[model samples]
Target: MDTFWKDLEAAAEARDADALTELMRAAAHDGGNGEPLGIRYDAARSARNNVDKYAEN
Candidate 1:
């Protein structure tokens, strides 16, 4: 398995929404997107629903 997290983190820190979206989608297709991208996804979803979590930001 190849790791592309460096690319993802750099993209995230830059706040590159397009890159972030693409990275998340790619990870999803690669079968592990949920854990990584879902951290933020679930966070956003939780915020919208008033659910709280201790998930990393």
Candidate 2:
């Protein structure tokens, strides 16, 4: 796989929302499309929600 995908996978595995967001922004910028940005926003939101849910347990 490409480095870009590797980095994304790493961030996801690490649960690093900030890193994921940054990568998504970069991807969206390069692609000139809103899809990546939307994905990034969702990923960050999901990560935060996951953390919050875990904390409630």
Global lDDT of each model? 0.50, 0.60
Model 2 C-alpha lDDT per residue in residues 1-57, reported as the tens digit of each score: 235556766776776767866775666555424354456545545655665566579
Write down the lDDT that model 2 would get: 0.60
Q: Candidate 1: where is the Cα deviation over 4 Å?
A: 1-3, 33-57
**lDDT (10s digit) by residue, model 1, range 19-56:** 65665566545644446645544433333333222222
Report clash pairs, candidate 2.
none
In candidate 1, what residue range of length 10 has the lowest lDDT sum? 47-56
